[model samples]
Target chain A: MNGEAPFVPDERDRALMLATQEGLPLAVRPYHALAERLGWAPEEVFARLARLHAVGVIRRIAAAPNHYALGYVANGMSVWDVDDERVDELGQWLAAQGEVSHCYRRPRALPLWRYNLFAMFHARERAEVERAVAVAAVRLAACFPGAVRAHEVLFSSRILKKTGVRLDF
Target chain B: MRERRPATLDDLDRQLLWALQDDLPLCERPFAVLATGLGVSEEEVLQRLRRYLAEGIVTRFGPFFQVERMGGAFCLAAMAVPEERFDEVTVAVGAFPQVAHNYRREHALNMWFVLAATRPEGIVETARAIENAVSLPVWLFPKEREYFVRLRLRP
Candidate 1:
């Protein structure tokens, strides 16, 4: 799906997204805590959250580890130039890979930018990240010559700033 | 709980991380369920999570929703920041509240970031502001489409 206004936000979903972006309180009953704060029953909050996850609006209800803290200092944003027709399959293939954290197909800015598929890889060392990229390169080469055009990985040198997307108000 | 450095991920810690990354079961007792399956007590699960949270190992532990679905806007923007002014431009761009997920990548488009705003037009305005401040051309690559966006780093 394009990053557009695809889903209609009901009142409950709005409230849930508004609250949980700060993060769920680390308590024995986080849903209960949310219910108390938002003036909804714990069951309703839980069920609605479940529905959000089911519909793919909520990507996950899990812990997000900081790679830096986990000693994964190197992060490579690998971009691939694959045949438009075959990108969907390649993206799905990359998504299934444990090394590729994020895989997406964006509009290719031709002439200047030739890549379409973007997959991110993380590691504690550059060598490890290089190896991962090398494997991807070889795999891409195995496909038809024009099917996989070119690939490049842009390793982030520093995180000038980073925070999750949240509603300001 | 015993003391461990930031780099070290003990046996229990690794298991806890794997649980958190892949499938943190959406139940009343997510920790309890994880503990039961991983052969640990609920208290231990919670304790490790708290530690992970405190130490910044885990950035967020909750439901992640799409910003666009809720009326917010986000787009990926990149710029070719000269090496001489790399750090300067980084700090200047990072100062904006609308900008998040900024990075210095190894490419001609060295500076990359995602700009998120409460409104759609705000994203464009933020991009312009970045260009003016850095005195560099800002390329806006709003996702014409999206195939997948998931991050599950194996511990």
Candidate 2:
């Protein structure tokens, strides 16, 4: 099964995602209601979801929050270019930082873009963020000498949408 | 810092993730409900989840909310840090509470990280802080237009 094709969602799984994504009803036994509407037993619906998750078809099923409502107003994306040998070492360290929420490495764009490290951070104020970044830079330098080359910070001005996958079932 | 690696997930792991992606049951016996539907016992469901988490198959297993909806300002920022100072730069950026995620891409402005603040001014202030700390001019690249921002893990 390791090399088998990824499990594709059938009509039933697709319908469940569509209904839930559109806006799950805020009533008691929402899943039961969803099952009723879809003409499936509640247990069966839940079971199907579990199976989907187990196969890596879905990442998680939980309440995605509205960060703005929670007072996390300022957000930005920061990237860096470090020594290839130490990139993973630095990446792991950055990922552990509370301020740095999302950290990943993607292929560089070349000539113009040569950096290879990235992280995300949210704050209540820009000044606080600046202070945090400054400290992070110093710490990173201490950990790996001459690893960081260049870095740029971009702030997201607007939020288009932050939803899960829109698969074609 | 640890080595980087991709996660290896199986069919069962994918099903669990799909279910959790939508929303975990909000009940006293949520696992029970999930297990019954999957034709497995609650213990089995929980055990597999725990194992997947331990193996780093799933980055996180909790709520992912819309920051702006909660009355917050967020932006995507990138900095041009040289390879020599990459580690130092990341450490400096990661110290802040607002910094949520950071990525390294192949670009002049390589180092990219996300910043969020409760107030609008916080955005500029944070950018400036990073600028002074890194001794590099940090360019604030706020999203002017967003065509798409969804992660389709499965192809």
Candidate 3:
């Protein structure tokens, strides 16, 4: 059996995740502060974080702005039913656009759901998002004519729950 | 529900938001490194970041882990609930630890949420449990392929 083995973080790695899960310290020397707290050298903390990043465990160390707080009140999940053969290509084009925050190719659920491509976009106003999506559709038609069949935008009305995943070591 | 208003920000704060979206360097003085690029003092950068967090302008600031790379699974699941039971169903669904984020979208499938689990089977199990709790069929739309996913936002 050639099942891919799961990556189990070592004690130090687990500690690192736990420490930075909430967020990294806002000190002048954040790594040094982490090292002092974790009882490791500053170099060791940096090396471990670098290794995690290299191995694709950490996507990035960056700030996530709250869309609502930034005047982007409308969050639209624009989905499309594109030609199966060219869906991936069109999806890549959509993803490259700055307006699209998240784009993915998901399976259609037959009669209930017909959209296979999902692109999430945010805007200060719902109309702005719709206008931008229309512009994008025009561009897609020009580049990949007849590739996109139908599309719809689903705006999130409320956030029922928002939280991060917690892993038990 | 908490009220949300756009925070008034200066040009420096705007620039800082744009700069912070990019990956910070792995160095001894990372904030200082960012300060140099932003042409501001390190203390200023730190102060603004702290304020942003405190004011909920920035949801999080740190390393984003790709759980899938660590043998975890995430599934985007949705459900169509009767309007009367929507609130009750939301609480039942949110009770599951595996449900990372839930959103109410304007669609027939009005309730959507993401499930993140340590193992792939955990997702299936949690979905089954949620279905049992809510008595609604959960439509799991796992990503067949990812084209792009950049979570940065312009302030």
* Interface alpha-carbon RMSD, every candidate: 4.6, 14.9, 2.6
lDDT of 1 by residue, B104-144 (tens): 78899898898877567878888888888888988877765
For model 2 the TM-score comes to: 0.53
In the range B20-112, model 2's lDDT, one tens digit per residue, is 555575454676777787777777777766565455344334433333422344666778889899888878877665666565655566676
> Model 3: what is its DockQ?
0.65
What is the Cα-based lDDT of residue A18 in candidate 1? 82
lDDT of 3 at B19: 92
The chain A TM-scores for the candidates, taken one by one, are 0.81, 0.86, 0.85
Backbone N/Cα/C clashes per model: 0, 166, 0
* Share of native C-alpha contacts between chains A and B (below 8 angstroms) recovered by candidate 2: 0.06
lDDT string, candidate 2, A1-169, tens digits = 1245445566786676656654444334556776787888888867866676666554455633333422344555667888877777788887777677667665565665565666766775566666777788889989888999877665544332233222222
Q: Would you list the C-alpha lDDT of every candidate in the order shown?
A: 0.77, 0.60, 0.86
Taking all chains together, the TM-score of candidate 3 against the true structure is 0.90
Instruction: Give candidate 1 regions above 4 Å deviation.
Output: A2-5, A10-12, A81-98, A110-112, B1-6, B23-26, B71-73, B117-122, B145-151
> Which 10-residue window in model 3 chain B sums to the lowest lDDT?
B1-10
- DockQ of each candidate relative to the true complex: 0.46, 0.05, 0.65
Q: What shift in Å separates residue A110 of candidate 2 from its native position after superposition?
A: 2.3
- What TM-score does the A-chain of candidate 3 achieve? 0.85
